[model samples]
Target: MARRKTREEIKTQDKWNIEKMYPDNASAEKDLKESVSDAEKYGKYKGHLADSAESLADALIESDRIEQKLERAFVYSRMKLDEDNRAAEQQALYSKAAAAISQVSSLTSFVMPELIRIPEETLKQFIEDEPRLQTYRHLLDSAMRQKDHVLSEKEENILAQLGEVLSAPDQVFTMLNDADMKFGKIKDEEGKETELTHGNYISFMRSQNRQVRKDAYTHCYEAYKGMINTISANYSANVKTDVISARLRNYPSARAAALSSGRIPESVYDNLIDSVHSALPKMYEYVKLRKKLLGLDELKMYDIYVPLVKLPKKKIRFQQAVEIGKEGLAPLGDAYLQQFQKGIDSRWIDIYETEGKTSGAYSFGSYDSDPYVLMNFDSTLEDVFTLVHEMGHSMNSWLTRKTQPYVYGGHSIFTAEVASTVNETLLMKHLLKTESDPEMKKYILNMYLDAFKGTLFRQTMFAEFEKKTHEYAENGGGLTADWMNKTYDELNTEYFGPALSHDDYIQYEWARIPHFYNSFYVYQYATGYSAANAIADRILNGGEKERDDYLKFLSLGSSDYPVELLKVAGVDMSQREPVDRAMKVFSGLVDEFAELMEE
Candidate 1:
């Protein structure tokens, strides 16, 4: 096996050009100071938005300018820190940038309440009187939509000041999981001492060697089990924060508060859970198939990730992965293809993993910068799919930035997942249509099935758990470690069904999931995957109208509500149709995979 490259060993061209945001620390510091000054000066608009149309317009414009600059500075610092978290200087830079942003947010906290205070008729007149405000119609409208939720200016300011303190749980969780936690070592198939890490836990789970998978699972969860009490306390505090904030905002539930920010209806969340529960039999069938294929007397949770039919390894280089991704995404049209090519040529991706670099992959940037991707590309088929996935996000960001102004350039996380998952779906379709090797074909089919199982089914299960836990907390129930464990364990059994044996350690899985801190965020993965499946099917089988509609959805950014934007893409997520359609697709894939294996 090839050794992983160190950051210093990786060629310059293979890394993302973060310097494009700032050539040096001195330059970043200069901009940081300028942004702080901008934020300080922005205080002049306090209690003055309702004075005149010109004042309102001026405040909005200046706020946008300050936010854009702060975003650029913050992104630069964040990328630097992610490149190597161990570096104290980079960490300090990130901290300073965060503090600067918090200060800006504190100063501007009164803007919303004051804007909400304007009479609806007067606000409409203000927009009409100041043509400049026309650009922010959606922005103003969204704030006004939350008029009932807006607290007094002083109360809002107090909440804003608590931002860092409120974030303690998430911060503590990150510090423990990423920086301090250790999972010890396990032996690989060849009996080599392999280290277990959060980054490679999934890889271990997917190992064909059942012992390795079992060892990895056991060791990983054992580490979490040791810290379960502490982690549970942190998580409970986080949940209480959510509950308190929601109540303070006059929302009936924490889930409602979280969804309202994206303008997604709580019914959409309910529909996802209900739809997935109705489709659990399909997942049960999937589990049964895996057990039969693996010839296991009884299946365990750790056995779920192993590929049913292992094929000869095919190693793709980074450049080859890029070319394949371009070909896979060609159905989207030439403009998108050209932009993707430009991003690649411009070093928009950090292409390899190195010590201290952040694990996993993400596409990130500001409105003014290129949609940059950070990837630990390893040249496996999984890596190729990841390449296309992040590109999906980048393309969406690229289009949104091009078509919308600064305020609307970033889309909601709900829509963001749809973009990335759509790419994964398209890539699977392209690979399946073109690949000739039967074993490789089976692998791809299994990959699609696994994606559905993980994204659609598993995430919905997580969504359900989050809902139940929040409800428990809202009712004044204590969120103890034993309670969380038992609750999570029961949910795991319910979702996985009778085909698999539930292990006690599996209850600790919730402690390992970092997304739980974000409060009701994982449901979007399930919903977005369902929406993407429906959209991908339309694009593949329908006419130009379908393709154009999806492209328009990408360009919309945050100009429209997420549900409405998805409707424009031909997936009405307000109903259960998309989730039902995705489940049908999963069922068909399972039937196809069984037939292929017989052949």
Candidate 2:
């Protein structure tokens, strides 16, 4: 068996230069101390937010500065911890950062409620009178929208101080999943023993060897099955937290509270489900095609992930994958590509999977720091896509932070997902157009089809589960292990249709997903996939105008409402046209796949 590499064993160039954030642990602690001091400075401005235009402007700027320090400190610590969860020193750094952030939150809890106390007319007058406040026009307007939801300063302080407690479920699950639990071992495709990890589980599921896939699937979920009771309890607590927090904030539902900050309408959420529900038949047809190609007596949950258009085994090494990503993303023009290359050269990515590292791909960092990416690269073609997907996210942050003010220096979760998926869509387009191998072309098509199924259909299923489970808890239904398993089982049965048979243990799959910790986040993957398809199509089919427009959209950050911001990129997400267009693209891909296979 090949031993998993430890954090220390990985080469320096292969890892992100997280030290760029702070020179050492002492420097990180110093940053936290600075944040705490800056947060304390907010006390003088607390009750006087509405006093004068200059006073309001100064207070808002100071608040952004305080948050900037706090976020940078927290991000640095969390990234260190994520690199290797088993390291005790890293764990302490993370706990310290988390505690400091909680303290900072409590200190600044008065800003919103106090700002809310000021009359809207007074805020507008302040905006007009204070030239400095002019830059914060959008910020003030956005904060004002939360007027009804802002709790009193004292109550908000209590909630903020309980921040760590509220987040405990996610932290506990992280330790259990990443640090403690083991999925044991399985035989590799070469018939050698290997460990089954959250990182490699998907790669194994993509195996052409059926026995390998089934063993990997069974071994992975059976471990979760063992901890099912504990996981369900944590998950239920997490859901209840969402419900209670939303109610406390006077939201009609938890989902409303989740979306309110982004100013997204409930209709967008409902529209995604309805649109995906309408398109489920297309997904079912794609499934039938998969089963027929595999020539299986009956397909099961394990069978679903294997690519129908099997090609020769080829490992896309990390360096080569980056080159492919660079070429595929060229439509974004020279400026975008230059910064991307610089990030690559500067070690903005943590490139390989190591023992005890977090088991997924994500782009995250503080606004002041480089937008760092953590990936579990396994050299599959899908891993190449994952690389580009994360780079897309980092690029969004890089551009936004470089362009927008500190307060607006991040992409809304809704638009953030679009930025990432657009890269996936564009890469597939580039691959199909450039590659000449008929089999490889078929494979790319298969990948694209599956991306649609995975992002558009699978994530929507997960989204539906989030919505239903939260609603259930809000309605007083208990989320026991048995109940969760039943709910998940029904979703799989409905989504995949008769083409796939069920593995009894597949029901426990929900317990393992980390995104459930972030309520209402998965649906953005679906909605974003839909919106990104439109944006990617426009860029590929149109000219410089489309590409530049899209880049501008990425740079806007949270300066405007997400739906309105999407329009700058020529994608109108406020309407159903984007989802409908994505469905059409899926149907076309399925037809093309059907043709290629028949030939």
Candidate 3:
């Protein structure tokens, strides 16, 4: 049996094979030099772009080519570091590539503002006059879309220069959390011990012993308590970054600015939060019943993940997880299913748990090749869900690339989670029906309910917290630790209701969530889950037309904004219907589970 790997072993595995990115150090150096030369070429075209339509088209094409190369280098470097964090050489290479990207961005920043300055009618004429320029019409239109937010070149340069320092809060927190922090051993009921680290916390939380779950939660927070102030400062700085950026861009609020990035309307955010809020009573009822099922005197956060039903010793190996995933996804039709099988056969997935291996799971790739998924498999129920989730991302990339051009190959993050979560919903439904064992069916149902609660309700709470903080900062409210805790505590009370006690340590959760620092981002997880559940229902059970619509949505890439794409996918998130439908699903699950328990 393969046990967890040590950091040293992981580093030695040559797991990433980053040379596949650039061939060797020499090739990387050559690319770096070529990119710098490309930067110079783009720089020369900056102010002189009004020569002619064809000239403008050629210049824009060259700039995109330069960007594509730089992007590839960055992807390769970043993936290497993720594969094995302890590799010094790969880290150094990533650093170099990062610096190169910054340099390239600075050189090309002049392109957009200058393009926006061109009269819209004149630009349209350019497109009409030059057939070659039509290919770039969307790119030009997107640049023009930001005309309201564009600043003078000098102001933009100042923001660029401040980027590193401004982003310090997130950077310092990442270093402290991912690299430094450590929690001591957690002792289970039988006295067996496991070291508590970020990567292993999930595994420990699933422990059968109630004491083990409580200890892991307490110890993990205890470790974070000492660094609470530092984390708080980091979060506050992030809030401030959004405020300052939004103010500079002349936006009404930071939330507006973030939504505008993907052309999302603020109504989408509000609708999701409002819809989820109305459904909290159902969620609370589920929790109360869960506590009763566990036979606990009172419920704490630690009780959430304990299995409601136990299977009779089914051990899903990492390989078996892949097979199950492929089988579960096969209903999407043969083309979608075949690529996933190819992904498994090609070893596109880096499977198994090892010390220092990255925690969580993700699928990432450039337009250059097949997508790769990184997972630390512990053969647990959640791991299977994660496999399906990441595969959703990978398969989305695969299908999108096949159907769209290189420029539009990637979809926005707003819609990305829907693809992943939809796969998970389908997988759970498939499992519930196919598994004849009553216990297994119940377990699968529990898993499905847990997904909705965790992904939708929990994340919406974070989203509400995020929106409040941004508004507070934008309105001249201080982002001090005290302010954050007070705001978060109130939101917790509102969402969780009075049945359960809100602990002081829960306040520190705002400090620990990495997503907040990324700004106005967590809400997508909530919205996406809702959107996915609705869309997945149609795709799975609504027959041929729904399936074709879903495939078209996947193939959309960036052809339209997220809202437009989702509308085509049969979920108009701009309206509140999807949110209401999803919450209704949550309520239905609670009712069904409660009835089953009564029987």
Candidate that scores best on TM-score: 2
lDDT of each: 0.89, 0.91, 0.78
TM-score of 2: 0.99
Query: Residue by residue across 252-315, what tens digits does model 1's lDDT show?
Result: 9999999987788898899899888888887888898889899999899899998898876667
lDDT of 2 at 349: 93
Clashes of each: 0, 0, 2
lDDT of 2 at 306: 95
Compared with the true structure, what per-residue lDDT tens digits does model 2 show for residues 1-599?
96689888899999999999998888898989888887887799978888899888899889888888888889999999999999899899889999999999999899889998899999989988999898888888988999999998899999999999999999999999999999999998999999999888998899999999999999988899999999999999999999999999999999999999988988988888898888888888999989899999888889888988778888898899988998999998988889988998999999998989999989999999999999989899898899889999999999998899898898888999999999998999999999999999998999999999989999999999999999899999999999999999999899998788767988999999999999999999999999999999999999999999999999999999999999899987878889988988999999989988999
- Candidate RMSDs in order: 1.6, 1.0, 2.3
Encode model 3's per-residue lDDT on 426-474: one tens digit a residue.
8888897799876677777788888887889889999999988888877
RMSD of 2: 1.0
Q: Candidate 1: misplaced stretches above 4 Å? A: 1-5
User: Is 1 or 2 the stronger prediction by TM-score?
Assistant: 2
Ranking by lDDT: 2, 1, 3
- Please give the lDDT score at residue 507 for candidate 3: 69
Candidate 3 lowest-lDDT run of ten: 11-20
Top candidate on lDDT is: 2
